[model samples]
Target: MNTISVQEADFDVGAEIEALSAGRCDVGAVASFVGLVRADTLAGGGDEVSAMTLEHYPGMTEKSLEAIVAEADGRWRLLGTRVIHRFGRLVPGERIVFVGVASSHRGDAFAACEFIMDYLKTRAPFWKKEDTPAGGRWVDAREADDSAAARWAK
Candidate 1:
């Protein structure tokens, strides 16, 4: 079974991988990715983003992530997958995203990890609000994210 979680609490990447691989013999490769809150925006906004608040549509968000994982499962010979995205206020050093994929081969595992992240950036319902020195502002979605997701289109 695949697992997807959106929580305000932090998670341990090593523990998550151990849990997923435990008692599973078929899994040969596990590829994972973790996203962190960067200090600066891509647009070169001089104002340093001190904090970021992530918002999600709850039920819809989980469903969307599940669908993305399902697609990865179908495209590759995946044994398991896990995605944990955090919400609420996050500082620069905090982890914002996690994607893990287990497969029989490294290629599949690598592709699945990248695929999940790409889909999550564009397909997921999570939005960000940045707290800058000037004030707070809602972050707009980037076109590059859309283009990344577009690569997976059939």
Candidate 2:
């Protein structure tokens, strides 16, 4: 099972992970990643981020996330995966995204979880605008994110 969601409301990680592998004895390991709005200056947080607004095209965002998860399923031996991304005005330290993967082994779970998040950071069609002391500014694609996603190229 693979679940992909894009919304403004926050999610419960424990619930999401549990649902991914619920009643599955074959799942030996479950790895998850939660992305948060950081205070990093490069992310437009300047000294402090009063708020961050994330936006995405209605239907396109969900489809893009689905494709990223499908790619991870093809690359790794995964039992299930969950991807939840939030869009709206968020404060620093607020959860922004979550990627959870379940598998028979820790390696597959970890790798698939990371691969899904890497692709999500680079390929997802979501845009961000941060509100800082310097005012609002749109975030740019970081080379590091691109490089991370590139390493898994088939």
lDDT by residue for model 2 (3-98), tens: 888888999989998987788799999999999997656543335767899988889899989888888888889999988999999998899999
Q: Each candidate: how many clashes?
A: 0, 0
| Clashing residue pairs in candidate 1 (N, C-alpha, C atoms within 3 angstroms) | none
> Model 2, residue 66: displacement in angstroms?
0.8
The digit string of per-residue lDDT tens for model 1 on 45-84 reads: 6789899999999999999999999999899999999899
Which regions of candidate 1 are displaced past 4 Å?
A: 41-46
lDDT of each: 0.91, 0.88
CA lDDT of 84 in candidate 2?
A: 90
